[model samples]
Target chain A: MNGSTSSQKHPLDGLLRTDRIPHIWCPGCGIGTVFSSSLIAIRSTGAEPMKTAVVSGIGCTGRGAGYVNLDSYHTTHGRAIPFATGMKLANPELSVVVFSGDGDLFAIGGNHFIHAARRNMDLTVICVNNLNYGMTGGQAAATTPYLAKTSTTPLGNPEAPFNLPLLAYACGATYIARWTMLHTRDLTQSITEALTRTGFSFIEVLAPCPTGYGRKNKLKASDLLKVYQEKAIVKNGANPAETILDLEQGITLGKFVEYDRPTFAQNYKAVTSD
Target chain B: MEPAVLTGEHFLNGDVACAEGALAAGCRFFAGYPITPATEIAEHMSKRLPQVGGVFIQMEDEISAMAAILGASCAGAKSMTATSGPGFSLMMENIGLGITMETPCVLVNVQRAGPSTGLPTLGAQGDMMQARWGSHGHYEIIALAPASPQEIFYQTITAFNLSETYRLPVLIMADEIVGHLSERVIIPDSSKIKLRSRPRPKGRKDRFLPYRPGANGVAPMAHAGEGYMVHFTGLTHDEKGYPVMTAEAQAEMVDRITGKIRKNLDRIIQVERYRLEDAEVALISYGISTRSSLAAVDEAREQGIKAGLLRLLTVWPFPEDMVRELAKRVKGLITVELNLGQIHLEVQRCAEGRAPVVLVGHAGGSVITPEEIVEKIKEQVG
Candidate 1:
């Protein structure tokens, strides 16, 4: 069957590759739901998909660039930020979006992602936080919540998961928002907001890795997503990370923090003028 | 024409001129960390790019500098970086990235003594080999070796074009001697010289795949936000840019990228053959050392040595054919340069052991003398 056939009625129906589905992601693996939400976000941006560039570094979420039909750049692990920055700067008119994995973005690619945000570059970064490295069979990640069990962290995670939104907020991203796949609609809206925003926009999507992290935790992807559905508080109401905590819990993830800040493009323009 | 102005114009060193050349070429993005002899290019770019509507970022380190320029290139500006020896070594990963991704960019390497940080301020063409095989993967690069500030100015433009047209990074090997030597260069009008830009996808932008080759090996690139698929990875990838780690796919993928350069060698390889016809001896050289070799050839000819000169403008493709033909015509070939001896070996191999090869070499910041090269010619001719 043709892959583009699924979105027959929805604007994004033709945009997705459904046949590739029966996906590698487990149910409640927020990646697929978030992936669907991203399609929705991109569809809503009204930016010509043809003119958008999707660049990803290695990871489950890094695959986002591959699924998109537009100029999709799947670069080396942890280097997508620079590539995306280059693509955006090469053609300031194009909307550059980065779909990166937590390990890829916060660990290996941490420096570039932070600087790009600081530059308030005119691009959007959608960080899919599964809390562990699922692509590599579940290694501990910077975003892996504390006490989480994984292949490497079989004894439970010792380090606290990075507050990605707080990091981005501190790095000076103009738009910073937090959401989880359980709140797919809200996550999609946040992604849409990040996509449409004029400056550097970073959205932390607390996705679940149903197979690796979820299986290890004995929680199905759906169970964790339902946990998200039940536990997640609104940005205006509660923390986004706190909503994603385990059977025991810590941080929260609603729209944690956001503010107005001139982007790198504007600052660079000012630097050039001066 | 009017008598050549000989040296009245304000003289700028070749390395400095490379910076000016990049500025003249409309390069807006420069990312580099300071490194010996080549530091002048970065210093100049840092001071000058800001004067234009350009940006110069002194990366925390060379690796980041290399990564940043690759980033800037996708931003759709003519991007460049400069280094010598070790710093150039740091840039290899991203240099490989620029190649596989077909990002148009320039990397200037002012060769200094090598292997490690051998001679910080000293001169050596030791990087001739690394410039070709520095990155781990199989690929072909357009590396230009200029002898004068004037050539550096012109060649920088060519470097940009070669990079843009081929959608790959071009290396400028400006050895320390030439990079520091003062020379006069006339910045030409933009229209007078050739320029090339990567071809953009036609019809639907959704059809744009970053790694797909167009009529030429290089597919037109759409910058980020241009709404195209641009997958650039060090891994083996298909034209559509999805990762293909299979050996067959790797072979095909590498072949296409390297082949674009290898097959187009005739268009990329450039050499200047001076007085090779009926000459009994020929001296081959590049960079500032070419000047001293030219003088040596003239002296040897005045002494009736029947010596000629062949200066290489393009180094990486090696100009093997031209060197072979010159070897056949001349009884003996003398390769002279500032290094202990680098390009000479390349000339010898290209000669295919056809003739007696004399290597006139020098090292570690000292200029090779014309007298020394003439002595080599005398010994070879005799």
Candidate 2:
């Protein structure tokens, strides 16, 4: 038989399950962009594919693990962090990454996210903040900005959204960064850096959910990207509390925290040795 | 370094014994939250696991603990967690995920009274049915009930073995009385102990299908970072571990999981019979009530009445065939338990009018008395 033709191959073919393409994300959704960027970052790290595992919680972003050609676990709703935490503790040699949606990682699984960060567990958490629950038909989520219309908040959401970078900073994450899908190069670079970091590293990608968070607000995918282009400011090392997102006010995007401390495994080893 | 098993007789409570048994069974990872009657298991594991080079984590809540064990199991460590009624309820969602993913792990429920935290320090068998059906979906489960510290020690090992062999979560249903009560437990030598491990994938790594079954209907498991590229999910999946959202896929998936246990009931079910031969009346009980029922059976025999006991060791997958055979020969079958009627309904269904089934039960907080069982036996027999 002749060798496989180049015409049939994609650039990131080896990193993804090509047969599982035509993924569940709707057109104009930014999850696919975030997922592809993550894979590129994983490849750039030169990490052994066999020694890396990806875990995801339930939602549109949760399907990221299934399409990746790695040891992937599509876990229950709001449980990816704890699951990845267990994997890291069980075998500290392996690199564990959790890829999930904003609602799953912040709303229902909020407790685990904070605790894992506080413990400085060795994990890379990629949170796709589409603002609303995209998979559940645009319901109001923990990251849904105030005055944004959603299925559950037709009149406009009254509850404030979480400033994720600030939350991660407050929870003692060793490395924290925020970027949008429009900044693919920076997002991929941020993920690459986070993957090599020793403690709990977090990257928040603000992506467009045109079908969920956009339709009611009369914003298309291009409009959202234009907003990011005009209002996004690169303010590295700015105070985390001052970096909250507001459509009217500019949204700051850059690495907010970077430091070194003993991870959970290192501390555990010390205690056991003592 | 700590020895795997103590290998000597020691008077220990049921919770401690369970922890020792897990360590002996090669369980190296434990994640649990503190709950009444089950907290001792976590405490014991915390002190002992580190010495044995095992990992012990006290999670923020029960949900995380359950999820953690599943993750640890996927990382090639035998993992377990312990909790009580409320915590057990919290674990139900993840337990279903475990069932769907076919992850081999052990969950010990040191049951306390509850309809929502009914009694924290007292024993109850109210969660027996919940252990089987609490998770939202159709699935089969294996749960073992232990009546004393010695039995819980042995049963904990059995739970791990069953989990490994069947590639599913196994439950240890120990009530509060059995959990806190102290008794002599003799842990056997490490070399003498038997352990079952999940089968490893045999074919080429590139072609390995995570959910493909073998002759026994159990798929070989490959741990994370093993170069298997295995994908596991809670959605209804095909043999390739790919999500298939169709009724036909659901039928095939649900049938294989439930059918594996149902088809192998003979190997999974365990019941102990005491003076069951040539009996006119049979007393069916499990957990703490089994001890009282045995005493009542002896009293009935001494009084020249032909009464015997059938003690269930494996509660789920209900030992229906054995009960049906026993029901055919007896005049009446009585189920004695701490709850009003849980396993009694199973016994009644299995009897199928071949014999009259009677329930001798109570609300909770304590074990049923032998005198009460004797009274029920007399009333049923007459």
Candidate 3:
């Protein structure tokens, strides 16, 4: 045992299940950075730890719920949003957050996402878009870019990816933003805003899946960060429809939609409470 | 405030009575997607839940409806959902999640006929086996079959009670005939109703193990936002509710969950016997078929045939010991159901060839009548 290890503790120790460490994430995976940023955002918000809950669907990023030292639930595939909705509606005092992956939020669970956003449910949905299914070994995902190479799409992806910002905006999400894991400060701030906001708040984070996605696309972990640093354009308040993600063109990053409307809980109370 | 139990006689269909039963049982959260036969339950809940300070939501689909109830139940609310065949099929995925996580919630499958949209408006008990093995993986579940609207009202409350005690999902497997039939239901006063709640964690909050079983082999539940900060997952987990990926851990988890009900079989399994005292022939049935079996038993007795009816109110942790005992005493056992020999197989297995087992089965879209069951009983007695 190292004597130094006993004296020094990580900063997020109070907010993490430190015993469950040596986490399942592979080396060079960007999910860790995004997860840490989320923890920091949750901590910084000063929300009551006891009253806050984290819900995640099945995926590599979904493991974030298990690590968080909160009243957390790791639910079935594509169901984090609905679970969060139920928790929030059942107890309005509790703050519910959904932390999951692109495929989980868009593929098997896509209908739930659309309906939750449409209801303007009070939830913070942080979707880590690795562009492919990381846990299942880099299969083509709903958000995989056209012509991108994955285990399921060796030649190239035939389907076009979903424009997450536009979908969130169209579905009535009150707050929407896009960022990369490399943009830790910006991503953290975006998450903090979503956590504090009412109604449906969505944040899409681009992350590097080195083992599952990078090798297939001939990009290293660092090369993926470089792509974000070089190609990402910071354009806050851009029309969601105008936000593009084509690598040859450029990646649009920043808050795209921010406003408020009566949330599902509020409307429920208004109608039900005589 | 609205009274939890409406203490008076009322004419109600089985579907509507089920909703009232849930409200009276302290079920405050209901999430369901519309499906035939069971749709009235949702409709009634939507109108009544709000009046009683409960929340009701019609989700996007059956899958989300099931997921939502699990989430609500975790947040310290008694939650439930109602659906039919197709919707029940969709709900199986999350129902498995509810079981593994040990979340207490009630699922009502007002079963209609179907492999796929076989007969949406018609009644059938074909989903009996599906209710037992619908969800993937190995786990024990509690399911109740109510023969009448009045029985459904009482059994729905019983379903919630069992779910709370066992810390698992309890199913009310009512058929379309029972769901749609109108009858008199007498809901007793709140003081007369027996309600059970899941055991809450005690002792030290700092050392709380959310999945640690007590003397009863069931872990005390600490709801979300109770300052315990418990973690729950659908994966096979340890006592601390952390995923433990090992065969040993898997065995331990499965054993504790299945064992809780297995050990307390007498308390969980409920059967109503009619004239079974001095009968030489036994007719075993449940749900709508139970009603027919009762009439058939009376008809057989008038014809000088010593016939008895054993109606299973609790169909799942099936009454194996009782069946075995009855098989030894009876000349033959006649199993009547709307399905093509689903629960009959269980009765046959439990009988162990001590007596002949005869199945009076149907193909769906209708209930097996008393005449049909009496005919089978006569043939079996001969």
Candidate 4:
């Protein structure tokens, strides 16, 4: 429809449920960009599409699992990580990825996120940080920057946002990265790397919610992308503690941490053996 | 080599026997959090599961425990989790997910008294109704009540079989007394044990509709990595397992899930009758209360009153037809339970005023005594 004829197929057509298209994301929402990049990465990585399962919690990002042509699960709010953990441990051969929003993954599900990382479960968790609960009408989320105005924070958010990478690093994530929708190539590559990497790998995608956070902040989708393009410093291997997001100064992007550790399954086997 | 079935009479508690029962039934994955009375089950499972080449995880909490077992079940493993009232309350949300996803797993709720952590160490039959309607929304569930440690061992296996048969979560509702009480449990040989596995999907993997029910109204299940590419959700889904939000879709989906058990109620429901033939008074009970009612029936019979006991091994599916038939033959019925008349309400409705129904109930923290139950039987008979 967008300059492509009906007969001209999309590359990710086989990887998606095409009939469920005209997806619910609003125009200029960065979730589509991030989702498309993920599909491309999954394809590029040569991961068995059927053997890969995507699990998601409630929110717009959570809907990604539904449209994906994989063994996906759309679980309850704040529960994708635990559900994916189960799927991974139950069958170690399957590649499990948890894709959900900041609110769904860090608010109600924050405990699960930290614990899963702590346990170093073999999972790839992709948190699409839109900075607010977009599906619930742009309410303040755990990733909402301090002083940001949301529907629930009309007076300005009093709480400081979580430094997601730092949290993952503190909780013993074996691999960690942060990228923006503007960094689609890097983000996609990071996802591909995370999928192949063992143990808990976390990727935080700073996405724009044009209708939610953007509308409230007086920044359009283009303006949001411009901010990431102009202000984002590509700092590969930067210390996670130094990667705190400060939109007024600059944002840092790139892979931060990658190391080997005995995963939950490995440790479980080791401890259980005589 | 240790036998799969620990085939010998051993004095064991309900929680330990339950763990052994799960082992014998081929449950290979158990994820649970420790709570009083139910903690023993997890402890035993942690020691036993790995020895059998199975897995046991003490999850972060009850919520994750429930999710983990559901995940294990989806991956083609018979899985189980054990918890008490407070932990069971935490599990209600994901238990709904298990039901909606049609995942076959077993959950053992060793009952403790509670609205919110009411009594942690004490036993109560308060969760009987919760087991039926704990999770939100309308859906049918199978719950078996065991009166003793021996019964619990057998009932645990039965729970697994029913869960596999229906492709839904089956509950073993054991009270704190039964969970902690020790008694002789005779576990038969592994060859003698009946095990049920979920029916595998037929046809090509690509065309298989994960939610499409067969003639028996239960869809075959496919594991996660088996390349079925199945999509599961808690939302209202169609036969293809895609979310379909409409009144018609909701009706069809709800009916299929609830109707599967409702239509096959005769096969799912199990009741134990004792001397009910030509009885003037019937003592209806389940779980630990059935033990007391059994004693009460003996006392009432000694007093020359025609008394009988109806023990509900399967507390759900209500056993409505059987209750209705018993109501026509018996002049009066006394329902005994540790709760404040939870199942008594179901018995009353089924009696339909053909016979006077009375409730001998306790609030919590203790069991209803045999003397108290006998008194209720006398009052009902008089």
Candidate 5:
């Protein structure tokens, strides 16, 4: 073997299903780590592989549906939640998971994500946030931090990024959490707990993209992860209205909000059912 | 033995009959929004699918409606959606995706006027060409136009069969006039009907190309989660269905989709002929407008103009060859429709310069009377 091949590539073996690896993600991408954490979570929950359906939308992460060995769907961008909601309602016995990027979930599919959260449809949405559009080169996105350079935001971006956890909590999601790829084990635990949460659960994973946003911003993937580790604060406010996230430093990470109320589908069943 | 030959009575609109037709086709999932003229189809489906252990959902929009049906179909259930003009437009992108991925599902468009919302509750045959070319890029579709309530009941079954057989989207090209008009329909026993399920690759495992064209141009469908690594895409794909963005792959993929309908023309094309032989002049029409054409032909015959009607039952795989043959024997062809001149052009193409073809139509919210068509026929005769 050549010296180039000597470095260990985090083999996503039995846990990640090596057969489907050499994934369609670009080199130095963070979506693979997000995907691996999701796999680990699904395994920890002990959900049957055949009984789970993985739904995704168009983007770098959307290809997760094809790469994973399960009943998966590679669908249109920003619409995975609505699609998975239908599948869950069709057979409530099966577990449905949605994996997609910020663009696929927030930009094109913002309406669906909120509605699905409101319904509390017993579905899990794992959104991977890489700060910029990773698939079409490094471009500024709704999730990109202020002043970060992107293809679209050449000099400096003026728009503020969306805090996905805060957005989901406000939209009536039963369970909401935010974790970073730097904290792999914690991220996997967050996803696993969200999966078994029994209501609409939303988990946002902040991953470092050394290639797209990183290279453009001159931040290496490892350096970006270190920045997150130093500045990250867990969101733990009792009231969702009082939730806080740092702007200049870094994003807050952890279970930001959780509340119990009659979810959309559950409350709907009470009145509609005889 | 004819299993329990139970029949039901109905003085129902064609839209209601279409719901019964979908249920009879073993469709249990209905996803749609309530739109004029097409609302009854969704209404009946909501009640019937639940009674038969099926599911119905009112999606937020037509985009979700299309996506939901595709999701249901992937889960191994017969699913459908119904809408009018505007909702149909929202559904075009996913419909193209369905055509490319070779997903088998039926979409019923009870067409209304457009060029941008001409009429809401009114009728129009304007979506005929849109059904064939609305989605970007190239693909083949099976479309059935129904003339009355009974045809709606029967053609919906044909739509589902064609969808499953060809593994493509089948359009039920009903107009608002036919959709709203009340008529008697008899829904026969479900078992006596021959419902075709896509042939599974039996004994042979993993060797399934989800898009492999069979002799009849329809391959077997292995629903998702059946352990087949079925790769579906909207881009040009080869036999194994992995998208290959090459010109040669594009040529093969386009031909595979269009060739199924073109090569198996006989099975795809369905037309009903009236007085095709002895008539010197032929009147051609489809959808509810065909009803007016039928009456006009009768009145013309009473006037001794020697004109008869040719009704189009199958609208998509255009009956060009049939029109060519009939045009050879007839002196001329007159096309009548609810729209300005949609199917009239198809008739002209089929006539192929052998005989001159004339158009008799209105904008289609209100029907063109038989007297109006008779007037046009008499003018040609004189």
Candidate 6:
């Protein structure tokens, strides 16, 4: 064994509740990487970590709030966005970030997501699109790829998955991007950019739910990572309408949208102050 | 924009009075969806919250509206929401979250008749039991049944104070009649009004246990961005606010959530006893029904019946001990409400065969007449 002092620590030890370590994510699951990237991105923004709050809805990824060493909230199903909205609106000093999964953010919480984006609320939303409901053992989800086998969809899913970037763009999100867990650096960089933005910023991270989704589809952990490496195409400034997650087809990645708009807080202050 | 506390006598509806009460109680955040009878509360908050440097958001639905208040409360803002039966039903899930997390906030249910949108514009007390057990859990709740516009105003402030003191959601259960009825409401001076805040964490900022009980089984709240870095969750958790998936954890958490009010019932429960000093029979009621019961008491007294009215101010921790005492002394108890025997069941249970508890109840499209209550009182006395 290499000579190492017991006092030596991992860099993220300062930002994470290390006691809650040995996390619940399964082996080869991409959520850990995505979560780490989000943490790294938050740190990179140079924002006081104490002033940043993370909110999550119910799911495997929803547990992100529990592990973060910040003022975090683990809310009910499909409610992270609204909870964060309340926090942000109530105290404009706090930077709010929503970290949740596809079934949580898109399916059950779809209405909140659209409305938050529509209002141009000041928030950073990171959706880990594992393609299926990972917490309840791989059920079909709103982002489940068409013809993909899942617990609920034993014979392959019939519904087409959502093009998240397009949905985000349509809902008036000011910042939108997509990246796989394999592209850690780019994902981290995009999230850092999002954390610094004012309006509703959305980042969709394509993570693999190895045990729940990978095993059901007859794909190994390595196979999904390989697919991400080979299929993902960095297409900055591409129309969000064309960005879809299809393994057989090319997976569009990189920053799809970035612009400026008057945030909800700013509008309230402008009209109310004068 | 009006001042936060309009300190003077003014004619106001129950809904507007409730909004003014919230402002006077140091509520700096309001989030809600527009529902009939309760819509005026949200409208008033939207105009007033901004004026006081507070925040008001009209959320997507009742679920989110409930959630937003919880969030704002966690962020150290005294927050509230107003809704009717349909919306209150929608808010049930997040209300459970508020209980589990022990977040301090107020929920004003200006009730309308409904199993589902039963009567949008009319008033009903059918949501009384719902207010107590609306959220799916065994935890106890604090609810106030305001009888008039003036009472609703003061009770709204009391709801905020109790929520802050107990570190959980408090309910202002006003039926549609009181919410829409305009009456003379006296607003007291700001300095005269009492305000309570959740206890704050002291000393060390690091390793602050968010769920650790301070006094009366309530924990000190650390708002976001205050350097506490606290974690709060809907799941059963330990003192450190980390999720502990064990029966032991659930027992401890649920105990504190319930025990806070249960152990402090004397301070939490309030009842206005009218002519109960020597009455042989009693009329038990709350909210709009309390008004009718008061009139019944007077009419029954004039008719040579020793009838008294027990108006419930705080309904959830149902003045059980007092009811038990009254049941033994009174010949019988008559429960009056807009719904079919909701609080009547509670009176019966608390009476424990000491007295016969009868209900002068209705299906709730209109108010229960005092004559009906008088008849029930006369029957009990006869």
Kindly list the interface RMSD, in angstroms, of each predicted candidate in the order they appear. Answer: 2.6, 0.5, 0.8, 0.9, 2.3, 0.8
True contacts kept of each: 0.62, 0.83, 0.76, 0.70, 0.19, 0.81
Query: What DockQ, on C-alphas, does every prediction get?
Result: 0.44, 0.89, 0.84, 0.77, 0.40, 0.86
True lDDT of residue B253, candidate 1: 89
What lDDT does candidate 5 reach at residue B309?
A: 83
Q: What is the lDDT of residue B51 in candidate 2?
A: 90
**Candidate 1: tens digits of C-alpha lDDT, residues A1-274:** 6576654555555665433334455545677777788888888888777676777888788777666656666677787777666556556777778888889988988988788877777888888888789888888988777788999999999998777766776777777777776777778888888787788888887777877888888878777767766775564434333444444542366665556777766776676675
- Stretches of candidate 3 off by over 4 Å are A1-3
Off by over 4 Å in 5: A1-21, A236-247, A258-273, B1-6, B204-208
Docking class of 3: high
Query: What 10-residue stretch in candidate 5 chain A is worst by lDDT?
Result: A10-19
Per-residue lDDT for A1-274 in model 4, tens only?
A: 3665756788899989887887999998899989998899888889778889899999999999999988889999999988887778789999998999999999999989998999999999999999999998899999998999899999889999999999999999999999998899899999999988899999999989989998898889899888888889999999999986877789989999999999999999999897
lDDT of each: 0.77, 0.93, 0.93, 0.91, 0.79, 0.92
Q: Which portions of model 4 miss their true places by more than 4 Å?
A: A1-7
Clashing pairs in 6: none
Q: Evaluate candidate 2 and give its CAPRI docking class based on DockQ.
A: high
How large an RMSD does model 2 have? 1.1
Cα lDDT, model 6, residue A92: 90
Off by over 4 Å in 2: A1-5
- Report the C-alpha lDDT of model 1 over B1-382, residue by residue, as the tens digit: 1111122344789898888777767688887788878888988876676676677766556766777787778767899989988888878877888888788899999888767878888787778878888888788888999888888987888898888889899999988877888977776555555667767777786565566677767777766545454555656778766667699999988899988888888889888888878789988888777888888888988998888888888888888888898878888988877666678788889898888887888665677889988888878867
Candidate 5 per-residue lDDT over residues A1-274, each given as its tens digit: 5566546554545334344456767666778888888988888898666677788888888878767766677777677776776667666666788999988899888888887777777888998888888888889888988888898899989998787877898788988878887778878987898877788888888877777889888988777777778878766543544544443465667776666777555664554454
Better of 4 and 5 by lDDT: 4
Looking at chain B only, the TM-scores across the models are 0.94, 0.99, 0.99, 0.98, 0.96, 0.98
Give the C-alpha miss distance for residue B190 in model 4, angstroms.
0.8
Supply the DockQ value of model 1: 0.44
Where does the lowest 10-residue lDDT sum fall in candidate 5 chain B?
A: B1-10
